[model samples]
Target: MASEHLHAISADWLKSLEVASSTGDSTSFVSHFLSDGWLRDLLCFSWNFRSLSGLDKIHRFLSEVVDGKPRFEHSGLRDFKLDDHTANAPSPFKLPGPQGIEGVQGAFTFTSTKPAALGRGFFRLTQDADGKWKALTLFTDMQDLIGHEESSSDQHGLYEGRKITWEEDVEAKFRAIEADPTVLIVGGGQSGLMSAARLGRLGIRALVVEKNARVGDSWRQRTTFPKYMPKGKLANFLDSYAVDQELCVWLSSSIASTPVYNASSARWTVEVQHGDRKVIIHPKHLVLATGSGSPRIPTWNGMEEFQGALYHSDFHRDAEQSRGKRVVIVGAGNASADICEDFVAHGATEVTMVQRSATCVISSTTAEKIIFKVPFPDGTPIEELDFRYNSMPKAFVLQLQVSGGTEHVKMFDKELHDSLRKVGFRLTWESSPGSGEVGLEGFVFNRQASGTMLDVGCSKLIVEGRVKIKQGQDISHFEKDGITFKDGSKLSADVIVLATGNEPIMKTARGLLGDEITDQLSPPEVLGLDSEGEFNQVYRPSGHPGLWFASGSFEFSRPSSKHLALQILARELGLA
Candidate 1:
């Protein structure tokens, strides 16, 4: 009901939890939870990502012994309180459980067993069968390491404290990194740079290897970033970020050969090609960060091939090349939509989008206002917001999206969706037809990366008939001047843009690390949810000792980079 009443209930529940936790009473601590409830721990208890479902599992996790000590007992978790600091403080929420049960969801703050670390979390309280309030879900995250906190975002004064000039200092740092980097990053895109930035802030010597000459060169060709940032602008921002963050990067460099990991020494001997020469280096940790691999181009049978130009959308920098030419974009994801709009803008003779399947499209503006505004509002510190957003488990977030949140979004964009349908554009929802998917949110968390399109302006173009839609069947084969569909129909085109997306990151890993290490990766596939509801083969352990994967959008990369860095830090200190 009232915000004050909800806050009071949440406070009471947290107080009980604090008392039980303080005394190290696992049973008493678990008594506050529903039998089937879940506890997702992130670097707070034992420096690893864990999801314990059911009271029994959670109890066992809490009671786990390592080196003759309780895993969570001495975790120094204390001083639990409602996290009123965040935008989404203690408030009323509806759990996506049976009957859409109502509950109180709140952000919380706490201190870890170690004085140098702080923790944050989220908890949902709901009435059980006996009408007694119990936790439906709980999340614990290590917020920051106190003494080793991230560097301030403010620029340093010209004459702060260094004896050497800025250039000299940078050169020295680069030399040190080149000589011996503690962590070697394979790519220099958003994920790689962000991870390097975070690791660098933690005083870790991280060297980024990029085949391109600049940090954001790869992203420059990509049209957009999360939060509606433009491609070119974001690319420049990344370049500036690498410099400002003092991240050491090796440009025009490629991993010359498959890296060899030495288990006994826990190091990798990697040969990197730098320009014309090659340098062999050994680093303790290797971060893939290699993106989603090469462009996924589906080949078709052709007698001699189409005379028209055909290329993957990765190289579709601008539609200037498509001016006065008939363009066919094969896909309905964001890339296709954007490319179609580009063609329309550049005055293509004809712009057609071949939609092979249903796409979940949402208004980008609406999403920014509704979904992002809460956790990522303006005037708030990014670190605080990152913790607040990450405190909620991704599984719980998906559940909410599936239950009614997706419908709320749909309701807001019903007019646009109806307009799209009228134009013969196919659409889908969380529970729509053939499969058990969570719609847009599912594509995000499950890493089905290309199934959703955030409508910026393309939907309007489609509705206004500026962009034509070709729905149904795959192209059977290529025609001299066009492509023939399975339905035996053909559309003439001067240019064919395949917005088919990229292969899974695992494929890249397989080629670079070989099947020996690739096959050992937990879950085998990199994208999609693991048993713990976390993305497989990324951030946390990869079922291998010193290998990690970093993937996802800028939103996920920026925040999760801290988690990934923390795990590496723990290992460096021999704590994990």
Candidate 2:
């Protein structure tokens, strides 16, 4: 049973409307109704009804009391059956809206039980001067379940045997953005495109700044292609109220019409070169929606002496390049799975996945298909190859040593053995028998023999490490030919792609807002941003009041920019 309360309908009200009332004792129900002063009166008045028949009489009596025509007919006294067909009947009540409020409206819907059975109509709610909420309006017909037959609609239906009412607030904070003029969007993704379409209906100018040369570049850059194209039904459903082209059209229009400052553009200032040159573009009211970058590679010794092609997953754009090559990939994440499939397809001779820890943290479905499963304490199963769990890498370097009285050098690490064993990895240490005038020759192997293994012979090794941002002068010499470690060892590489992650890149936008506003909008440290980091979803810089920051952490499930743009546009146009 649902609990009815002051200015709020109790679950009991919903339960009472069910086909069959619950047999549960009414003690809890009685207590819940009594919990609210107004609900007690309503329930007490309704208590006189012995059953559905009595309920009809009460409905008539209440209709008379309110000076409204009875919309429902009572049948069979005390056992009165409510005409479910009355869903099409007109509502007789209309409550006044609060003073100073205009165009006040609301809507709700009810579900249907029987197949092909029509559902209930929408109902409207409005607020009174005393700051109280009420159902002041309702749909004329309940037969129209979709609520598209009329200008207003509400639904009331039984869900899990309990009646529920979904009421829409007449006053959403973002209603006016649909009617604004000259709206500028910073990022050209789903959020920006959605915002543009909404604004376009209102005759507003919509513009987007996309640093990339093309739209949807982020999705295209992924190593694995989507299994199927998105149906886009959800986007269409949301845009039913507005008259604009498909979401992509709005995005493409914004991208094509807006002057793009790409690598070839003269306006391009920042430049980075490895295999290809990437130029950075500066835009007015910039949006840092570039998303996450590549994973970092850990430093290791003897890495230079391996004489293999080293690469990160981000830098490996094509698997064809690695076909028939020996490959050792580190890390056990989704990217690793994607790369594994790509390597096999591209004809990689053998693939070895080294997981640092005993168990993986992933879902059961993913675990079942994979050859290995590592369970975390939280009941989340991760692919052993997807995440290393608890392993650390130690650096090795080439050096001179006496092997059979000849000078030789190789990588050596006692720390690697200890760390691997601590994480449940089986370690095997082997040393060549010492000869006269020569020291012991040795090598250590931390391998999972039970899991899938790849033959190692002239294979290309791919290493992926955790990503972190390097600040200030720390990254100044990062692009140099050789990497100089803190321990004073140097490693040379044919190619080094800084797979470091991206920061908020808030320099230009922060300058526009000035210091005071940035401080106010800045996020606390817990949200993964530093103390100086600004993480507000709706931020209007002080100096440039109209400029807003729409993208930052909000709910991880849904991107925040879409929600933020709607709210900001609404407020700017006095729609809220």
Candidate 3:
């Protein structure tokens, strides 16, 4: 369809939505949607991330009053208009509805009066049976706090009021944060660093506490880290990012005491153990930017009787150590692929991979071209990509993926997939059951976190039989020098490396925060989709006041950092 026709359709819908929302009329508001339409709000209508499905839920969300304040009025939503940006202007889109609906999709901007904030939104409009255009999905997200716009851009070199040099100015700022941090972020990896960087731009005093001695130790310390990502190069970039962003970090530090949250002051008193000394600090908010959990090690009978070196993939840094040794890796994810390839590359005698489940395999080369090239092409500003990628609702993205995205992946990797399957590597397009996600794209969206490998060089070795495969049986037990399968087959090995992934983030949080606090968390889990099909907890509210979770890969981390910072700023300003 013509772009101008789509623009007119979007403008008309925007007008109706604005009139209904501005008047705070629930019935009129929901009249613009299909019965099963979705509304996703991020720090706009509420101080948290929420996805409401169906007209009933949307009506309740728009009409309900809490604390004697109508939720719609509390949002103070007004002035809805189509975004004028060329890239995000109204265009055609398709959804995988029962009828395979085609629709007009566009970016929009709005004003939030209650908090004095600006908001951005995206919507998909399709014709109802009566020929009236109704919304299939609408996404609203806070763009920026009015008075607290990000100020990370370069400024004049002149020291306006301070007589001291730039170094002295930054040092003083860092010291102030060290003494009285407004936000404390645990973990110094990309998630934490990005959060701190975003928070810093908003003039928030944020400190990153790293258990390691350096910024990127999380990647560097992993022995079976993927070779496609240059560890040293990324580590250097992280160190540079921390310095360039002026992020305050405490290296070789850890939480010494379980944090105590005082609701009265909305602050957390945490004890930091730096080397041998313990320092107590109080921060208004605590951000857990930690990943899912520690390396998962499955237990089998007679594990203690094994005499040879047996460890998780975390400890296998040097492939030379496996030279002339028969090694068995117990997983089929990226880590396992890397470890198996390392063993074969280093001339390990009979390196075998024990696959207990189907895996999602895609060619790394093809993935680079299909996935990263378009959205993240060279020379495009990252900030633009960040906004573009995140503006669409998760469920909408899933529809696109299921409709044709998976087919595209299958088409591109057909040859590589055929070769791997011919050699007995089982492939799957679906995520774990009940995840409600499909295909390779779904595996990533749900953060299945493992059981998928983007084949770099590992598939070639597996196809050539340099890396042997053992499949279709559960591990019965561990023998003195090897592993025994349920089929009574045994693979003799000098070393057994369990490359299984980590436990859920909630398990790790339970260990750190205890059941009392962790149990109070909403959605009941992390790293997966909630009932509303949105990521649970990460970069959003944790149900516990003054606590937040910041996680996901670099792509998610970059834009979400701003959202996290905005939430923190809103709380500090009493806008929530």
Return whichever of 2 and 3 wins on TM-score.
3
lDDT by residue (tens digit), candidate 2, 329-385? 554333454566566667776654444322212222332222122213233333211
- Clash tally, candidates in order: 3, 41, 0
Clashes of 2: 41
lDDT of 2: 0.31
lDDT of 1 at 91: 77
Reference-based lDDT, each prediction: 0.82, 0.31, 0.83
Worst ten in a row by lDDT for model 3: 93-102
Give each model a TM-score.
0.91, 0.37, 0.91
What RMSD does each model have against the real structure?
3.0, 22.4, 2.8
Q: Predict model 3's lDDT versus the native.
A: 0.83
TM-score of candidate 2 versus the correct structure, residues matched by position: 0.37
Over the stretch 1-576, how does candidate 1's per-residue lDDT look in tens digits?
Answer: 888888889888999999988888889999999997879888887767787778888888888885676866868588888877566588787543234667888888888875357888888789899988898888888877767677755444353676666777778889999899999999999899999988988889999999898878887877554346677787899899999888888899999999999999999999999889999999999999988778999888882589998999888876787789998889999889888878887899998899998898989887787677756879977866676566666776676676666776677798999999999999886433643546677777775656788888999989998888998467889887888888888889999998988888888889899989888877888778877677776788889888999987877787789899988987887667
**lDDT for each residue of candidate 3 in 498-545, tens digit (9 for 90 to 100):** 888888788877777877788788777777877676788889888999
